[model samples]
Target chain A: MRADARDNRARIMTAADDVFGRSPSASTDDVARLAGVGIATVFRHFPTKTELLEAVLTLRLERLRERARELSGDAEPGKAFFEFFTQVVSESASKLAIAEALTAAGAVAGAEAQEAGRGMRSAFNDLLTAAQRAGAVRTDAEFPEVYALLIGASRGATAAKLDPAVRDRMLTLIYAGLKPYA
Target chain B: MRADARDNRARIMTAADDVFGRSPSASTDDVARLAGVGIATVFRHFPTKTELLEAVLTLRLERLRERARELSGDAEPGKAFFEFFTQVVSESASKLAIAEALTAAGAVAGAEAQEAGRGMRSAFNDLLTAAQRAGAVRTDAEFPEVYALLIGASRGATAAKLDPAVRDRMLTLIYAGLKPYA
Candidate 1:
């Protein structure tokens, strides 16, 4: 692809992310308008609205995976893992809404998005393992369990409509629970 | 009230619980048939199916509150609180289903049921306080935080369709997080 074409694709993805984040049912034309590109160009890039949504979801997961990769290199493994965990839970609300919107729009997660999800999980597991090896987290903490905790915390906080302070407190308690017992 | 009338009402409630548990969409006539009572009798006890659902939900919460009360009287505060927490999470799947069914059936949780829910919360708080005082739980934990944890844990487990053993392991990890760091 030409450099200009790659830029156009990236712009379309960013615009779709914004439009769908606000309204899951937004049309591809809306994304095109937001991207300041022709509808023909948007179609040229995505081919279909579902494909555009799929690309956006995949990009979101990939961004997280990239962030996790950076955090995994931090010297303080415990701090790195906990901060990544907190950040993920906090960001999950909008991401979940987007995913649900994609589902509601009849877009089955494509192979690319699913693969990105696996990449995100693997990156997270690396952080968790680092924390445990550093004696920051409980050795018994499994990836699945922590993953459920992340889902639950985000979902519960959203359902409860908790204020930031209260949600932070809850996260702190959960972090405490995940740590090795003295 | 006549003794037989009371017995018939009790029987009707039990039948409603069973029928709704199996099929949230089941008709009240089905409940009457299961109770071996006339439709008129069921109507006499609960003027509306919503009323019947309200009564059952209230009864379920009341039972948990009563159980909490009994556990509060136990000599072991930490054990009592942890056990009650686990039991509540385990049972939440069915109760939540019933609640969702009630909502789908156009039943607003009646004032009585809401009151029972508060009563249950208060009872659970007593156990939390007892556990904290006994040095089993961290003193800094607040009621709202713990409540959110309960909601998250139950909802997450259900969403994951986790097996019982896996759910228990997750619960144990949550319990560990709630405990004070030595």
Candidate 2:
């Protein structure tokens, strides 16, 4: 893609995320205006609100994957794994329904959503695997279980409107539970 | 009150709980039939199905209170507190929507539901307070926080369809996290 087109796509994605964050009912026109782009351009890129949301979810998956890649190379496996977990949990707090939303977005985004999900699983598994190898995490603690726990915790935090200190406290407690029993 | 009338009410309540447990949408006729009571009897005791459900929820709240009372008498404060948490989480796995259901049940049940909720809180707090004083729980931990955590964990367990071992695993992890950060 050309530089201007790439820039337009990035701006639209960022704007869409921001707009949608504030309200799931945000209109496409609102997204276009926030992106400083024409309505036609927004339509040309996403075609529909569901598609736009799909793209946003896809982008988030990619960002997490990138962060996991960076964390995977860290010297401190345990710390890096938990930092990544915390980041994912924090990002996922309000977006806990993203998976269901992506599913409901219809057929066009199905393959893409699964691809993003697979990418996310792969990314987190990399961090978890490394942590286990370093003997920092419980040997039997599977990525799937951790993923399930994080989903629960994120939604819990959102429902509770946790203060930052409380959020940190809860996360730390959960992380400790994830550690191998001493 | 006559013995037969009391028996009918108990039978109706037990049947209603069983019926509602399997399907929240279970009909009053079904409950009446299961209880071997006439439809008029059912209507006489509780004018609406919502009222019956409210009655069932009230019973659940009372049961929790009774359990908490029993646990409070145990010699081991930490063990009793955790035992209560585990039991509540277990019973609550599929009933996470009980509070919302009660709220939507309408005006008559509202005060009673709140009273039951308060009763549960007081009971659980007694165990929590005892545990904290014994230095078995973290000083900073509060009953409200624990309540929120259990709600999240219970829903997560339901979503995950966790087997007994895995359920125990996750619960242990969360419980460990609940322990004072050593």
Best candidate per TM-score, number?
1
Write model 2 residue lDDT over A1-182, tens digit each, in one string: 89998899899999988788667688999999999999999988889888898888777667777888899999999999999878866654555434333233234455676687677778789889999999889888776567667656665565555666676777766887888877
- What tens digits encode model 2's per-residue C-alpha lDDT throughout B58-174? 887778788889899989999999998888666545554443332232344567765876777788899989998888888777665676576556655554556656667778778
**Model 2's chain B TM-score?**
0.88
User: Against the correct fold, how does model 1 do in TM-score?
Assistant: 0.74
Q: Where is model 2 chain B poorest over a 10-residue stretch in terms of lDDT? A: B97-106
- Candidate 1 - CAPRI tier? acceptable
Q: Kindly list the per-residue Cα lDDT of model 1 for residues B118-145, writing each as its tens digit.
A: 7888999999999999988999999988
Candidate 1 chain B: 10-residue stretch with minimal lDDT: B98-107
**lDDT, model 1:** 0.79
lDDT of 1 by residue, A11-92 (tens): 9989988888767788998999999999999999889888888888888778878999999999999999999888776665
Give the number of the best model, judged by DockQ.
Answer: 1
- What's the TM-score of every candidate structure? 0.74, 0.74
Interface DockQ of candidate 1: 0.42
